[model samples]
Target chain A: MNNNILEDLELFNEIIKEFLNEEKTTPASKFISPENIMKEIDLKLDKHPLDNEKYKKLLKQLINSTPKSSSKHFFNQLYGGRHSKAVLGDLLAVILNTSMATFKIAGPQVIVEKTILETISNLVGYSNESGGTFPTGGSMSNFMSVVMARDKIDLSINKRGMSKTLIAYTSDCSHYSIAKNASFAGIGRENVRYILSNNRGQIDIISLEKEIKKDIDRGLTPFYLNATAGTTVLGAFDPVKKLVNICKRYKIWLHLDGAFGGSVIFSKNLKNLVEGIENVDSFCFNAHKTLGAPLSTSVLLVKKKKYLYKSFDNDAQYLYQTHNKDY
Target chain B: MNNNILEDLELFNEIIKEFLNEEKTTPASKFISPENIMKEIDLKLDKHPLDNEKYKKLLKQLINSTPKSSSKHFFNQLYGGRHSKAVLGDLLAVILNTSMATFKIAGPQVIVEKTILETISNLVGYSNESGGTFPTGGSMSNFMSVVMARDKIDLSINKRGMSKTLIAYTSDCSHYSIAKNASFAGIGRENVRYILSNNRGQIDIISLEKEIKKDIDRGLTPFYLNATAGTTVLGAFDPVKKLVNICKRYKIWLHLDGAFGGSVIFSKNLKNLVEGIENVDSFCFNAHKTLGAPLSTSVLLVKKKKYLYKSFDNDAQYLYQTHNKDY
Candidate 1:
């Protein structure tokens, strides 16, 4: 097995070097249709393992045919291009293959994740009482915020079903995950009020306040207000400072979805994009987007750390052997 | 940037070669206390980038101190030891760095994921209507099942809040994610009835039926029945064949969580462990667990593919640029 790993790594080096060279010249690899995919590359998994030579050849073909998102010409989504250092870190993670759920099992790797969360928390101007976790993606991060908000507004909602018509607010310009998350959280898609956005794609505060007042008139309990740090289409940052006052007036949990442009916090000039981030109840930003980290490196931070534990904590004797809080 | 990537790859090769040698000699990496982690390795992230030499040295120190999960002597989690081929594939994925959300962006990679899902669907005896998606992990897979079941039982549950008193049944020995998912789905954790397990660690069917009947008698709806393929502690397979009939009589959605040992279906000798799996509403297993792939390669398959779309299909014009169904 050791020899096999070394030999494969050698093959990987050769193929990646060739692929990188091609990326420099062509940038975008030739796109193969779905129907012609099987002909272009052998993707079949068989009962028996193939020889090293055959396996390496097939792998080279597959890698050559894959889309070159790292190429300079490729610009389809929010994430593009690979950072060399970040890629190296990801490759090491694959080699280590450790689960970060428990401290005893993951060891220093847990600290590695914690350091990232802590740094991001501080960058958002959160106090020592703040805490965060890396969810799977931007969608999951948004979903976690909704769940936490729902539980915080009505503690019995987790143990007992929602007794009141709980409402949530987000701009129409926000990511589509808000509606999906609303349905997933059993709040119902109809319960989510999508306030209209202005021409610049920022949330219309007047319209938002009107909708909240309307819901309140109907005897509905409004809980969460999802502000967008970076709207998906226009790349607009909502008026966070203005929205903070509105959220406070309504006593709503304010969550900022910065999946598209949250890395502005790292930039001196762009920091003003999310000026009132410190006052928000929770904030999430995808490191993979602007930071050039690997895909799905989303960070979710909560002002008061206990909400994360309250919403996600579940006791399993077999898995969580240790009783440490940090883990 | 190209030169930097090549240099980093070279550094990666050297460090990995040394790491592999250490694994062969001493499989378990040295453990460092959380308190001493900062002193042991330079984990701090700063504003300025370090020089290549210093950066590489720090990376080497960090990787050396990290837990050796892939080593032969490591027996901490169910996922131990790494497949060299899978590692190669993961490294290639990192290099490609494509988002798998849409066809235009992902291209042939979509076909690769489809092939794996199709094969798994067939292995579980799913018909042409069957389909699957690679969720982030086993916990997310189970959560999807709950959400799907919730939406399927009452179609209005998605657009409107859950109006009925819906109850779900699971074994006491099942994964802890069941309760967490229930709370996330707004089903209420108390609504998930934990049927006691027998001495063999399989769910007691008699108690399960009694709970179902009692829920129905109290004007409550029994919507989901989660049967464990392999109980986390004892590795016991529940009587799936018998539970199918009970689910059918109650019209409950039967979901099999094979996160721990669902790969038994791949073994001809052990295939009988998950007998009558074809009748299940949904099934999920972790390829990363028994299959020796990367950490979070979980596959969720449904008997009727439309349920997946019904629960998770949120249209984003900016994302799904193409209208093809296969994407």
Candidate 2:
């Protein structure tokens, strides 16, 4: 058993060294011949175990064929690059393999996540009352914001579902996640008014207010406004300050979908991109994007901590023991 | 930089060796004095880098102090122990750090996940059209199943937001996630009729049918039925075959939350526990529980692929640039 464990570690170390060196020259796999590889690798699980030598060879082949996302040359999407500390932190997390649902299971990891959220919340100019949690991805983060907005609009929505025709406003140039999120929130995709954007792809503030006004005039409830900080296409920062006035006037739950461009809060020079960010009810940004963390490290911060409890808090007697509630 | 990387690797190697040794004897964390550890670790982010020796010292302290989930003595939770291959796969995933949302970005990883889903679906007697995805956890998996069932009952629910009074059924004895998931799907905690379980913690099929019948008479739409393959507290398997008869009679979508003991499918001796499991509309299990994989390795498989598309699929032109239609 010890020999097997050592063999696996030695194999991993060798692979790590080879991967780091090769990634410099090859970021994307040379060719993605799926059919050919499927035939060669034989991913099917048989009843009996294969020879250790064959298994090791197969592992190496699989590793070599997979795309190298850590390399600097890999720029296929918004999230790229890697940081050693972040990698180390995630590796340790996997080794520990604790569930992050409750404080009892996650332990100090809960505080670690909370501390990071608190820091990001502070950077966004949120008050001490602000709090957040990490969702699975930017889409899930955005979806959670929509859910919070929906439930906040009508607390009974959690109990009775949507009783009114709810309207959400997003720019035409914003991430497509808004539409999907609206769908998830039971606010039809059609209800998401795609206000026209200007040449720069930022939501045209005038157009946004016009749509909100029209929705209200039509006897529809204008409940949510998703302003993009960095849109997927042009990476445009919306006029957050300008939008805040309309949100306040209409009692709209303002959510900043800063999933892409929200990282500018880290740069003292570029923080102005999301100026007046604190006024928004909730804000989300993917740490995996722009910040060189691993995938699925998105944070969702809300101004009033009560909203999170109001939206997501459900009683479970078994999981939340009294000893676990440090926060 | 090379020296730093190598030193980090060596430090990791030493830690892994020590952890493996200690795990044989000690499973649970010896102690958890968070406040004291917080002071010693100095988790506050400073303006400049701390001393290398101090940083390494802090990292080692953290590794030592964390709860040992992989240890043999740690039988406090459903997911314990670790497979070396699983660890290797997860570590490589962190290094690759690719988002699983789109096929274009994830490349072969997309196929890898899909293949796993396909394999699991086949094991559950799902046809070629059956499909699934990896949610953040078993909770998320259960939530997805509810959403799919909701949407399937009234295709308009996705767009119109639960026009009908929808009701869901789950065993009295099951994972606490069901209540949270019910609230998440806008079905309300009140709407989830927890049918009483027998002495073995199996759902009372007669009681479940009685509740479904009562709800139908009262104008409530019986949309979903969640049966537990393994109850968290007792590891009880619900009478899935009996539940399926009622589900089919009422045209309700049946879901098997096998989050705890779903691996019985692999055991010829234990497979009888979940007999007639293939008839359920959807099923989910945590590989982390029985297979000794890492946490968050839950699988949710549906009888029909369309429900996955109906609930979760949305257009993201910027990210999902073709080549990922396996689902």
Q: Each model's DockQ?
A: 0.67, 0.51
Q: Give the per-residue lDDT of model 2 (tens digit) for A72-158.
A: 887665855877767777777777787766655556666677778888888888999998988888888888888888888888887
- Over B7-85, each residue of candidate 2 has an lDDT whose tens digit, in order, gives 6667677777777677666656556665655675567666677777777777666666667766656766586577878
**Total backbone collisions for each predicted model:** 0, 0
Segments in model 1 whose C-alpha atoms lie over 4 Å from true places: A1-3, B1-3
Top candidate by DockQ: 1
Root-mean-square deviation per candidate: 1.7, 2.1
lDDT of 1 by residue, B84-155 (tens): 778888888888887888777777778788888888788889899998998999999999999999999987
**Model 2: colliding residue pairs:** none
Please state the Cα-based DockQ of model 1 relative to the true two-chain complex: 0.67
Q: After superposition, how far is residue B234 of candidate 2 from its true place, in Å?
A: 1.0
**After superposition, candidate 2 runs with Cα above 4 Å error:** A1-5, A324-327, B1-7, B24-28, B324-327
Q: Give the top-scoring candidate (TM-score).
A: 1
